[model samples]
Target chain A: MSHHYIKTENLEYSYYGGAKAIDDISFLITHGEKVALVGANGAGKSTLLMLLNALKFAQKGTIDIGNTFVTEKTAKFIRQKVGFIFQNSDNQLFMPTVSDEIAFGPINMGLPKEEVERRTDMALQRVGCESLKNNITSHLSGGQKRSIAIASVLAMEPEILLMDEPSSNLDPFSRRLLINQIKSFTHTCVIATHDLEMVWELCPRSIAISNGKIVFDGLSKELFYNQELLNECHLEQPYLAKIEQMKEAEKIRSAN
Target chain B: MENLDRVISEIRGIETDAIDRGSRYRINPASRIIVCFLFLLSMLTFSVFNIIDTIPYAIIVILLTLLVNIPLSYIFRKTKYLLLFVFFIAAFNPLLDRRPAININGFIISYGWLSFFTIILRGYISVTAAMILILSSGFIPLCRGMEKLKIPKLLVTQLLFVYRYIIVLLEELAQIINSVKARGYGKNKFPVKLWSVFIAQLLIKTYSRAEMINYSMIARGYDGDIKTFSENKWQRSDTVFCIVSILIIGFLRFFRPFVFINNMF
Candidate 1:
């Protein structure tokens, strides 16, 4: 009955013209786990993330979130439990103002006005964007818009979070703030990103996909150390991992 | 490209002014909408060549713009482009009707010219009033007011979505035009022959983007209805504002104040 895990079985999805976006992919992420989904462009990373919350349903497989299955009838319930932050902040934020954007999900879920207000305030505080509550959504800077988009999803209080390129187009300071915010979350998170450095610093596990298939899934260190696999998946070792390797070599050379 | 940027910035400015808390004329959006409706009705009641009667409505718009602290220059600038279209529509009037309608001293004025000016005046006044409504009450609040006033929810929702996405569409267009300009293809004029292709590409891009946006909305629990967070209550002041505005609009429509002034002259 726990609603904190996601399990997919042999999922497949193809666009109308018959190009497969996700081809026979499967993975399991348990409660409170932070898994980084890393892949090159067109590697189906976004498609898989959408599949997790029924934003894009699989044509030939099943996805189970905790004990509940993701189906047409259950998408509404699944969406409540799984919050999605789209790669483009503009697309995710449709409301006019920041407060309205944050309150949208909760309001749709039929929460009381007071509870919605509390959640809105809490989410804004969580993202450190309380000052932008009344600002127009279209007028926000890229970093502020990303933060508000995250806050909007966080207001729903979902048990699982699926973020697609959350740090994309953000400045260094904004990305660091986002990293800290993600690090503070206790919910199970599946982040599809190209920022391997973020993967090293935050997620303990990494899943690398290539050409609609998951090529590697294991500990973050293991993935970073496998240069062959990284190259095959169009990925590079995390900067932190490279630094650690260089430091170890330096220590050995000095000892010799 | 510069024009697009100005438009985008102008929209942002209007949004800011719409939500400004210090404006003295911030009434409930529903009341403001009703007043705007009545104002438009009164202005449209003037027959062709009855340009003098529109003066009172024009004064009301100017006074409201001043009361709301929106500069006259801003309103004028926003309505100028729209007035060009009005000019286009009214341009043929003089050509079609050459019969003289008035003689001021030695100069003769045709009915067509009078009608032309009257049409331009009416267009300017209507566009300015609408701009005032949006400036005084933000677009979202206006839609909510429409909903409260028994406008169909579907139409209101469509209006809200169109308003929200028009910015995105414009941004996309700017990007496309910028890229085209970078390639040195759109210097003097965007090649007329390529317009069809350009429009098709833009449509495709927007359609896909719209699909992605729809998916995001669905993921956030968007059902058929778009629920809002802020609900403005209809205060006693709103009722008073509505009553007084309707009364004034009624007087302007019925009394013919300009004719009395002319008689005195």
Candidate 2:
């Protein structure tokens, strides 16, 4: 009896009197599905993610998270369920201390102090950043900041996570750390990233958007090998996919 | 750019040092806040010329600093700029009044000189008390103390936001300045006109970043109200500290012990 955890119908949005950032897009994510959102620059992946979080309301569409519709009345409730991690860790980690940053969401939800503190500890442990509980946010390195940002989102215990460019500015070690954490999550995750390697490893399903339209929607395994569609959407085949291609060529040569 | 870095580092150093000090640092922030506030108010009640009467309050500040394990040298190092600014402001007092007020050891001292010295002493004592408050309570506790004292919630939260973002803004500015230097724009010197442009760009970037942060906050269930984690509570020690400090301030303001000492002499 699994239903769509997140559903959008003909989503369209514009930015401040400019052209449409998201135009005529529709998608549905089932419970516990990790989907990768792939697109070129200005292809509206981020705008769509914001819509899902209800950070921005669509001018001409509807969004539903779980059974609740995303409207003015339900925005607060929806936000508590959909946690968003922004692209820039600097923007996300605004609190003075790491512990405060993690507790902010729960505190805002009107949770009791003990509950908030408990969630903060749990989130820090889950991210393997327990040692940073007392560290100041500004003093942390880039990797530490990213981990704390993720911990902040995780502390809310959200049912769905919307992450924008999670691995964009991270070092390889940090990226691997993040990929493993995302891999362990059972919640519905929709990640908008340029890191196709992350897509290959962490996401089972892939959705590609171009000109604010979903150009491809299928398994990551199928989408990576579709050279024509990857080129059309201005995405490169992931390194692992290229390795797989080389292995196929070797096998053909040995059989010949 | 280096100067900016120095200022930021200095502020950060002061903040960190304030939090990591000794036994007084472990005192309830509310109690420390109440004591420091009473101390400040009692000093303010002294007549500007009643410099001798303020000695007890100054002693209280010194004792508190010692109790907190914040070194006198650290206070002077952090507050020298403010102290110098105060000195310059009080410099004109000595030139304005010419009436001879006191004859000390056959040396005539003008009222102007008397007021000048009084002003300097007042500035030193008051600024020193403020620095000790910062060192003892730290910024977060001070904000919480203000909240407990029934300051407007909006104002208290705004104070916290401003304090947190001041560092963020300074860090952003430092990065931009460093980037400009890295680009070979100005190595040793920054031109005023170029700095103007850089500042304008910084404003735009800050505005956009603030917008993004606002959205992120909304996405995390912030509903125009900020709720803070209440980590401080009133203890028996806090009550004793507050009541005893208030009584002492009342005694100093009313008794004028220095006046009695002068009459005895």
At residue B104, candidate 2 shows an lDDT of: 87
Listed in order, each prediction's TM-score against the native is 0.92, 0.92
lDDT of 1: 0.88
Off by over 4 Å in 1: A246-256, B21-23, B88-113, B185-195, B259-265
Q: Tell me which residue pairs clash in candidate 2.
A: none
User: Top TM-score: which candidate number?
Assistant: 1
Please give, for residues A49-99, the per-residue lDDT of candidate 1 as tens digits.
888888878999899998989999899999999999999998988776899
Consecutive 10-residue window with the lowest summed lDDT within model 1 chain A: A90-99
Please give the TM-score for the first chain of candidate 1: 0.95
Over A1-256, each residue of candidate 2 has an lDDT whose tens digit, in order, gives 3533998899899899789888888888999999999999999999999888888899998898898989888888888889899999988876657888899899988888899999999999999999999887778988889889999999999999999999988899999999999998888999999889889998989999998889988999889899999998899999998898889889999999
| Candidate 2 error regions (>4 Å) | A1-4, A249-256, B10-15, B22-24, B185-193, B257-265
Candidate 1 per-residue lDDT, tens place, B1-265, comes to 8999988777666656677732455577888888888889878877888888888888888887887787889888877888999999999999998899999998999999999998988898899889878887888888888998999999999998888677767777888888778886556576677878778878888878888899989998999788886757799999999898888888788878887677789
lDDT per model vs. reference = 0.88, 0.83
Clashes of each: 0, 0
